[model samples]
Target: MSKELRINSNKFIDQTTRLSFKFNGEKLYGYKGDTLASALLANNIHLVGRSFKYHRPRGIMTCGSEEPNAIVQIGNDPSLTDPNVRATEIELYEGLEAFSQNCWPNVKFDIGGINNLLSPLLPAGFYYKTFMWPASFWEKYEFFIRHSAGLGKSPTKPDPDIYDHKYYHCDVLVVGGGISGIMAAKLSAENNNETLLLDDKNILGGATIYQNNDCFQIDSTHTNYWLEKEIKNIKNIKNLTIKTRTSLAAYHGYNYLLAKENLTDHLSPDERKGKIRQRLWKIRAKKVIIATGSIERPLIFNNNDRPGIMLSSAIKKFIDFYGVKAGKEITLFTNNDSAYETAISLKKSGVNIVSIIDIRDKSSSKIVKEVEKHNIKIYWKHTIVNTEGYRRISFIEIMQLSDDGSGVIGKKIKLKTDCLGISGGWTPMVHLFTQSGGKLKFRSDDNVFFTRQE
Candidate 1:
């Protein structure tokens, strides 16, 4: 067990910063300036959820949108609960109740473990195979399937809280707060363009704040500081509004974007103070640069739904940004160059990395060379075939894959570990580009789809 810590409420907020919250129906306390994820971490409660299929244990994986775990059912009523919400991203207020999703009875103990014993009988798209067998019994079997599917639960009652949408005008809009986002914002501010940078996280420093993570090879904090200095130096372009606790939900023609602001939920349920809980900001920009970044794709395999398995990017946020250790031992499975940064970062953080299983044949890339220097063992043309763990990942079975990636056809390798980090590749969030009617094409080099000329 880890040590538990609490806020010295009296020092941070006036009128005694006491707020009530609940997790799994057990009431807890929170204070002002606490996001649901942070508050939960403060309590030393690591397991907040379970895996999708195998009912394995899950903890918060990231602090921001990149989170793959820590998603929970918030609020008491059906309408109030936001399913699949990143706990680290939500601000906590008094009376904020949450519960683990994808778990039966409780997150710690689940009947789903039985799936592991019968895993060999399951594979990717197993549901498609099982539902057809009896044909006549499909209807009866569907009930059990539905109950075991999906993350989070629906509230039985209506939501008591209110949520609403605002329109503003800006000369420039930056969609991310990472290095690129900050650089764009700084440049816009310098050019005297009324600039606004929007990010869903509570802090303006995006991935840079987690400098200890392996992905952060450069000095992210220094870059952030330079951006801050640049913002301060400009007198004319200084009219910039950086929305940290805001997300750009949509983009429209003429460069219009919609943003949402969470106002009161982080303080306490009763501390509304008659202020609007949320507001929508519609902004028109002459130019928009989306540093919106990318999301990790999970590898397809049998029993991949085991708990404790998540995107590698998520691990960085949990350990570096949240100051919370996700697991004692972690195994990273990747088919790309990016996940190597995660393995390196975890090793540097004193977290034991069981091994790195890479599916690539060979790489002349600089990152691959670095992996060799670090002495991190790499598996070529291999992928995870199955996993075993309950409420958390305990071990993984990897097998060599056919060159065409249609199937696995080599000897199996197994490693003992607690967490499994996977990344098939990345999916650039090109919603805005597509919403603007932009076309996307496959990029052979990146092995991803990117916006291309029509």
Candidate 2:
């Protein structure tokens, strides 16, 4: 109920149009353009779900489809209910009903939470080892196990929503709507080619729209300002068609692909009546440009899966685009320079940044200096060994990295924190390429799997 965490800023959200929704029976309010995850974060509700095996508390970890947690059941009616919907992808709508999955009774105080205390007894293959005796009795063991380990429940009744399919042919098809994809579409259309561009978000500019910092510039203009101008230019091209909220689901040989366009998911229940819920598009293009962007990989550490622990890039998006702060006090842990931008953004937004723990020993990057100039502390050659707090992160135990960078050394230092944003690096979006029979090559320096060129 209280929009205490919501900041008064001219971001993506329309402050005048307020939408009310319910999560686990509690009514909450958000703005017109806020996603379900951003709305929840604006209300300071982070513990959204529970893990499958241990039943540990989980939270919204990302701002997009790469989210590993924060999946919930949407809608109240049995036939209209959809399960395992990513909160990051769901748009906030009036009367939207959402409930966390996998936990018995409720997410906060779940009975299945006992499994966390019994974790030592349940290893990775605990089921295979414990259920092995008497192969004939395996059926009995499976019945109980099946009831315990899983995500949201599927609707027993038939789905009432309508879905249809279509076919299209284009001279050039761009799989992403990021800065690169938009430029590619513009260039192709200028050459008298029919260009079609697709993106998963409701907006076309992609991540470029959120780059509001002064560190990046294009021809003496801020990157975000320049990108907005470019997007307007692309919109004026007659031969170019841009489709937002359209996801490419499958890619086959000979430049053939399948995409799904969301039609009414962002609308209110009353407005969505009699409208198509989704449409499948079968595309045949002469040339396809795979401009899908990269995904930020989360750092691996002890108790890293706890609630309130999120990706650094996601934190930036929530702050810069949605005008929401993840926490009053935040600690960022990163291996590279990307997170420094997030630190600067949050600092400028009046967030109390506890410190930035960089695994690298030293950095003279301009962004790093900018963060330092803002009086934000930076811990170089340090890594988090463990974290504290049950439902949400309260503090973290950090230590100096070993000389060879294989382990941690020295005594642990504890710092109070409400949120931890970690950035391990990025993995290129190569799913479409691999699905189309393209081979991949792993880049050791960046620890990314890239498409192998002929």
How many residue pairs clash in each candidate at the backbone level? 13, 0
On lDDT, the leading prediction is 2
Count: clashes, candidate 1:
13
User: What lDDT tens digits, residue by residue, belong to model 1 across residues 48-144?
Assistant: 8766765556776555665777788876555566787788777766678788888777777777756756778878888897689888898899898
Candidate 2 local lDDT, 1-109, one digit each (tens):
3455666776678989999999999999988999999999988989999998889999999999999899999976878888999999999999999999999889999
lDDT for model 2, please. Answer: 0.91
Off by over 4 Å in 2: 1-4, 132-143
| Cα displacement (Å) at residue 167, model 2 | 0.4
Clash pairs for candidate 2: none
TM-score of 2: 0.97
lDDT (C-alpha, whole model) for all candidates: 0.70, 0.91
- lDDT minimum window of 10 residues, candidate 1: 6-15
Scored by lDDT, model 1 comes in at 0.70
